[model samples]
Target: MRRAPWIRLLLWHASAAIPVLGAAAAFYGPALERTGGAWPAPLDDVYIHFGFARAAALGHPFSWIPENGYSSGGTSLTYPLALAPGYLLGFRGAWLGLFAALLACAALLDLCRSLRRLLEPRGGPGAASSRWVGWVGWLAPLFVVAVPLLDWSWFSGMEVALLGAVLGRALVAVRRAELAPPARRPAEQLRAGLLAALLVATRPEAIALAAPLAVAVAHAAGSLGAAASLARASLPTALLLGAQAAANRAFTGEWGAAGAVRKLLLSNPYPTPLEKAVEVIKNLAALRVQALESALGGPWLSLVLPLLGAVAALDRRSRRVAVPLLLGAYGSLLLVALNATARYQNLRYAAPSLAMLLLAAALGAEALARRGRLAAGVAAALAVAALAAPSAGFARQIDHFARASANIAGQHVEVARRIAARAPRRVLLGDAGAIPYLSGIPAIDGLGLGGYRGMPFARASVHGVPAVVELIERLDPAERPDVFALYPSWWGGLADVFGRRVDAVKIDDNVMCAADEKVIYEADWSALAPPGERRAGVIDEVDIADLMDERAHGYAFPSPRGGWVIGAVLPGGGDGAGGGGGAGGGGAPRFDAGRLIPEGREQSFTIDAAAAIARGPAVLALRTDGGGPIALGVAALRDAGGEARVEVPERPAGRWSEIRVPLRDVAPGDRIRIRSLLGTFRSFHVWLLRP
Candidate 1:
């Protein structure tokens, strides 16, 4: 019996640990500084897990929004669980993720060393150790560390690293049984089965790898062998998944995790099987487009390295061990191709598969070693050159980590602080991750990731405008936001839907709201009739086209605008503050001939009578649809008392109210004001034009 290769294993593992440690320090050191020693993961998704883990640690159920009931917003079963013990110890945040990542790297190194020993047995008959081939296995860990996706994923608080490690262990066990066929070790089979079950629970995508692997391991015994292997793999996997589903159902009133629903919703608006198939194809195309640069490093390396790996995998001596690596890589990629919707961010979806491919590349280099020193050197040179670009990309990602922590994550923390300071009570919010998590508020997640599922704008499509509108619309009255502080530009077409003009106080560069009292638009604006016919300039002289009942003049507007206008009497304000129209819902002003304009587009109105503003500062109040405020500019104005020109800027609410524009020396009866509807407004009403 040969003694254990403890020295060699330790040396190989140490070699791998060096780069991982160095990278961790380089990336996480600055992240610590940026986050003031908390070392929060850069991605928003990381907090999604942290929220769950923190709850779990506190002896509460997993939930992104704790007040919102049991929410299975977390995607991984084991990751949050892994964070549990440490969180119980009061050590939470990126440090936990980083430690998990280090363990995963060490596991990968051990798996590679074990696999090398299996392929080239020591002290066995006719077994001559190949020195260069040994170097390939030793160097393989370096490849794993260098993959850009793996680097970011390790720090992302995601399950990628852990999944790869467990999956590698499972493959090694199954391949061991296959290598010594006809003598199936029940112990190894049981170990492999347990690992496979954990793999499924880890990411769910490993089912692709697990199924094929079980069959391959059982192939020698014909039908009977296959059945046994299938049962062994299937039973444990089924039990774990079934138990999870039952727990999820009991806790959240849903069978699967909320994340599954969110992903499915993101994949297709129509949840039919056929639409799902179409979605997979679309996702595949996107993956292909992004795969070369993001996953495989670049065009040239992606093409060349895989061909070399294929050649090495085909060799008879390397076939037994090589097959599983190739299968793992291809199966993982297929899983990503079918399931992953988000294709960018450099191999995030296919991270485990990349580890497999890296091993295959090393195997290919090993096969080259057998041919000659020159061939091995060439393979090594190409591998190094191919890795250079990703190394640079990884460096940039470190910078991304720091910047995101400072700008995005830090801003969220600050905003949550301000919100807490201003509104001590819980508030409904969009981008529910950081704000609620930081502020300890009970929030309604507009994106539904935090488990508020009544998102009307939640669609399979990535278009955010419709999603946000639907999210806001779907909220229960009780769940309506006090003030929405989201990026308005992201909510496309909202300016059209909400009639684009209201009185608002600008809060941050991104925030604008009326403090619980301002009306965005008059409720009766939708009752106004469409402008009839294209009458030239000031229709009907004094009236400007009847100023009521939708008979307003259409100028500088789109053509054939009768049906283009749609109206809705939006429900009264959720805050229960404003009265619409009149006290008894009578004598309210009607707005008509309103047009929805594209963002950054403006429309103007010219008033011929200078006496319109003769009475003190002329009032030019306009009604608007209520999403928020719209800017109105009044230029080339006049006072009724004399030939005094003035320009006034005003933002009006969703009412028939008037803005008091100041006048120099106009008398109380004298009026002088010009109307120029500015920014994006639903409709402008001129009361003075009434006949």
Candidate 2:
């Protein structure tokens, strides 16, 4: 006897859950054994969500650390809120990750059920009631559960499974709306809207899928008109997304969340629009290639799946469903392409899109089965062939997940525990995941994913150490970090500038940590002395190495012909001791960092001489890295008049040299222009001194 529908649904879920749960066991077994039974999340980023969930459970949503006011760092506002209940129920420490895994498992089961319903034949006079149809329904869910990458995502303690489930549910709702009668269309559209809202709240990129689904709903409205249906289908998502933007702006002073700002290529600074476009295209192309090899099961599946989707779309009966699914799959891939980290963590970013493509392929299989028994057999054979490679590699993926989890445990978690033992007031670090979450210590994310100064810190880190030093010096004393834990290779210059190494964590056979070693440093801020405490006759001092500071002083390289390199450090060491030389002094210049201006380039700085003790003639002192004897053409412009050009003769090479340009008729609000007429040299410090 055939099973009842509910019983069959239960069986489908059971089949899906079996592999999922078994995979979870296989992944966690080795991870726990390696970490001495301390459960470690496969990726350090999972702890970031845990931190946000802990804050939310404590009545402070949107905060990374409850003590720190508000942080828009959590990527998914709803994921953390969903996990908050676990925290409230005392799922602390490793249990919280288990709770997340359980949530993901439940989501995977729901996704499987949704896919079965989506692929099942609808009731009609000639609808296929063949035994093969039932088998297809049973196998579709199993096929989804079988993909190694998707299974890895399901157990990774991230939101990938939840996103897939919500997207699946939304697709089903939209499909129902497409088939429903005009009288019931609005209600189904509303249902889809609510699900889309949930999807967007889970991951903002769901708009890629949700958008086309909204259009599908509007198309289904037919003669009834699209406005009402479109509104019903789009309202919830619009409101949720708008509220999220508002909250982000109110808390973090940015319209986008901290995590997105830190990671998206769109958020990075580009010198020109052409450069940005070229880089984004290059990145997307590379990501698509990677997705084909891994995320889409294999390169062969990439070709076969799209061909199947096209076949389904060409079929008169399946065209409506196939078109929307194709659009959604393409959109999802495009969304993943925009992500800077799309290639990392086993291509987790592409998992949702993979689900979409698989669903479309399932539809194509059903369309083939509708033709004849022989065609049905052919479709079944194709399905097996498509899945063969991914299924074969499942064990290897499981091993990778286990080792990655162990890596996080041995590196990030171990370091966090050690730092926690110190009881430091505030810790600063680049990898802002496990340390803040596991240690429960306040933190400043040097990469800016979990802090209020996200934009400045992110931009400074990209510009290199001199800009970072300037940013650190600008911070209030209270906000400055006391303990620094960072990868020496990643932030070596920063380590040299403001840190004294006190401890280190080294891990072996590391597959996922940024580096094998994470060094802990005690901060040393003595080198950043105030300008007033420096030299007696100094009127104004400009550190040309600091990009933002230089920009603030109207510093620029005017010609496209000559390139400028910011934060250029000289090879020879200077202690960064302040105030060692004046216009004619022989003492070595203390500054060791500068901007390297190429030959024939003009560099200009506008100084407010009103701040000087007396606005008379001043000595323009240039501390430059010694390469060769250099000649510079210097001109001064004042509100009253312009001064004659002064030529600065080349000094000795192979060391740091101070070249003095005497300014005549200097007054308040004067602008100085300096150009390298002969040699390409780095200018370390520019000073205006009382003559």
Candidate 3:
């Protein structure tokens, strides 16, 4: 604890930080400007926690939407609680997020220092410290800050940095005591237990990290007797976790957070437990492959660090702590890998494993340094170079993240602020991430990712069909979004499908819900009107529907007519929709898309007969096998189109209605098409009539 050593350590920490932070600043500078003074994290999920923190700071429990009561929307119980103070002090958005990450990194540096001190075997009878111990000690922290993935995690405003620091601290203390078991400090042991508790509270996943640490701590505390020491080490953790579970159960009616359950329900690949376990192994294997691919560019550096470290840990000098450390790291990783099946999952899932490997490498480097100056230099240089590519990769990643942040601020954040200013409090909306957080209103998430209530809809499988439409249709009447600030593609067709008149306030390109007005518009119907046909308008009905993609607000399913149905509702629509093979309802098949167009909405079909249509007004007609109220709009391809609903006084359930639309209503042109603006008809057709 000499001043010289402390000062040298401080300088080394600062040296490691400057370049990494400089790269971050370089990326964040323009981002800050683009976001209009608010720094946004790259991931929208970060804002979910920020919102929770903001809510918690206001003396409420963690909630993105307080109006909807407590929903375990935040990923970590402790992180939002930790971030609450920053929000109370008025550091909002990316600023608050960065502060939390930086705080964790500081803790990380402290843990690294403690680890270096604990691992360096100071002047034992056979112990010889390496000449490069001082420089090599700083390498771990340097590697952490320099790597893009690790560095970004700290700034991404998640629990990674905090988890790293807490886990690292406990491991360091455990290592110190394991090395000198006779001098087991009860106070240190209790503190490690508390840290472990905090780690678990930060992320339920840390339970895996804690399980091994518990064994090691008990093993090291043998002097105090196993049971007594185990109790001392476990009591605090158990109490903390039990209390959290009780609180969550009381508030959210679930153990842990509903979010985790919801995620598992949504992502779980199999129906049965045994199958799920098998799938989990496959997913972990896949993740391993992905991590290997990522490290292929720097295989020697990546491979050597962990291998040398693991090998060094077996040496008599480092065996006491290194063995348990390696076991815990790998054990936790295996557990995480088994549970993590996200298609987009990456190496961050195995952060603790990586940390353990790095520590082992550091120990290995120290041992090599003990041999000679040349060996130490080579070891340190190799380790540094190994991390260099990742560091550079992360620097570029920061730039990409900055741009994404800017986009979120300009679009989602700005729109959220606007909606908050205009929309009613507690109104439900779709795509409920940033807007709900920024607006301080409850959102009925259209995509089903954020809030717990939307879990069913979020997890709903439309079997490669349109998820948004099926989700909107399935949502309970009470849970339906009152206002939507989503793209036209999301809600334009929704108005027709649901029979709700949705007035959209155009906020740039994204649509804002204007709830007071009962006016509904589905995309720009005029835009969908064939622009003189893509090729010659094929009179094929199936081909017409196939073209309406997200750009066209259309989803395609199979049509019984030896073709496909675009955005059509098929038979067997009930509670078990999309669950299995259809249990058919004894009703005529229906085509459903756009909002539920109860009265009727426009449907367009391309006509190939341009010359025939030009010669005379097209007689637009449809033979409905069953008809109540029928309507059709006929138009030349260039015409604005005209609507005509047939009045069937004797409405019959199973009778054909031969309805006709006049050519006078349509502007003169060749390639004519038809639009069903209002009313219902089971099926339709058109033909050119000589004037």
Candidate 4:
């Protein structure tokens, strides 16, 4: 039996995927160990996510405390947020997020090559198709592994990248199997269905991948086999879906609104899914520029790929895979919208389609050009290089994982711990959910995305400040709660809300918990500040939250020119911070640009002088909304020009941190405006304030 050159070619390319995988493994080796980090509720939330999923598997209530011990945010329903939990369980908490990312990259390359294989045999230079797979495999490690390491903080635990790979591979499998016999095609189609289902299970919106797979499935089905094929192919998908449905039913008690799908399954006034999709698209388009920047390491590179992808799709040779490729790309882009953190999403989100399209572009380039070898070689080199650099970085970081745990070891978690310890068993706090979940303290709401939906977040009975005060008054008599950790936003009529029962205490600094007041004040907040570190210097910096982007590591607010984020809007938004966190980033008239405000709207900044300035800039510094996409940055007045937008390292939206700039250049009476960097020129989209 003579072996075909193509099979050997594919096998060789597949075999070559090892070093690329190994390289990726080497770079992100550190994350493979610990689960929790100093960051927000992503990985830990995943722990909570898996806890609920595993609980569903075992038939337990969705509670982070599991048995006892208070926590906040119960039973979060967002399954995509929980995918890491499955990996943690399977990988034994190896933090295989990086691995998933690498796999996704590889999968995209595979998608390109397989599609090439199908197209080449017909008219696209079929025999030479096998060689292209190697380059695709080469890119797997590059984009997935290396690029993410450029910034140590962009570690989103590899969920997006990995799931993307699974999606791309599934598409590739569908593409490769498209030419299968009518008799055997049913099985191939079923495989595609299973792949699509897995993707949906990993991420709720991932059902977008199904559109392209459906195209591929329909393409493969014979006229006579259409009815039977749809049935056969859709069965495995149905089974997986059923499994998710049962899990959803177990937790949420409804089949349609099961698992993480519950969030999407609900009836909304937005009407049809298309409307929801429209809303999602609106949000995505707002961050398109930023998403591109985040993906490419800078803003300009982000612009090139999509533009190039669009161009490639238009090519005559690429027409076959172009529509599906574009659909996948558009679908992938949706993941960045209307949720949180659009920055890094631009990078990971487009990987599946981008990777595929690039490969397809490369394949098309090869098929159409006399310099196919040179063209493919260059493309392959860049792809391999992208994979290699990160793999190298991972090797360097692996040794630091253990050190990372010990170095900062539970420093931040301790805050949540002490407050929970001092408070009563069932006490509630503003951020009780996250604080307790991280510190293992039992606070009010412990559920995250999934569990939190069903939990009591707000009650109509306790809506107003006076009503809240009354609820607090009632609590002592019945709920018997002790401490109250009030976030400033809730601090509103809360005292009035709690009636005479809850006492709203304003701590002088950021430190809290009476138990460690001395240490918290002396050591925690103030102690970290350098001597004379209180100047108005952070003004020159850029804030990405202005762009509705949340994927930042930490903010670098220079000397305290202003200590607090002053909530201010131009005189036109109806005076004061009345609109806080409502339409335009709640109060700023920006922040929520795409949703609540129009594009290209511009307004001025104004602040009240007789108000509570918090002794310095602590109260004067304008705080932006953390609700919209992150990267919501603050741009200080400089050069009398308000055209620059930069990514803010910090994304703490609720807390007021000062932004100080050298006022030497501008006169004392100059009117300065600080608006959200969110991409909207609309006056509504721009938050305006003058301090």
Q: Evaluated with TM-score, which candidate comes out highest?
A: 2
**Which regions in candidate 4 have their CA more than 4 angstroms from the true location?**
1-44, 53-136, 149-155, 223-282, 297-322, 340-412, 419-424, 427-443, 446-486, 490-691
lDDT of each: 0.52, 0.72, 0.53, 0.38
- Taking all chains together, each candidate's TM-score versus the true structure is 0.63, 0.83, 0.64, 0.50
Q: Order the candidates by TM-score, highest first.
A: 2, 3, 1, 4
Candidate 4 vs. true structure, TM-score: 0.50
lDDT string, candidate 4, 370-465, tens digits: 236675665454444333333333433444432333222233244455554555554444432334444444443311232332321222111123
Q: Write the per-residue lDDT of candidate 3 for residues 176-215, one digit (tens) a residue.
A: 5555545546766776777778877777766766665666
Error of 4 at 377 (Å): 5.6
TM-score: which is higher, 1 or 4?
A: 1
lDDT tens per residue, model 1, 222-332: 433667866775577778889889877676555766556555533432245665667677766766555545545676656655665686678655554456667867776
Locate the minimum summed-lDDT window of 10 residues in model 4: 518-527
Clashes in each model (backbone N, CA, C under 3 Å)?
16, 0, 14, 107
Model 4: lDDT to the true structure: 0.38
- For model 2, the stretches where C-alpha displacement exceeds 4 angstroms are 124-132, 231-256, 265-290, 294-302, 315-321, 338-340, 453-455, 530-594, 599-691
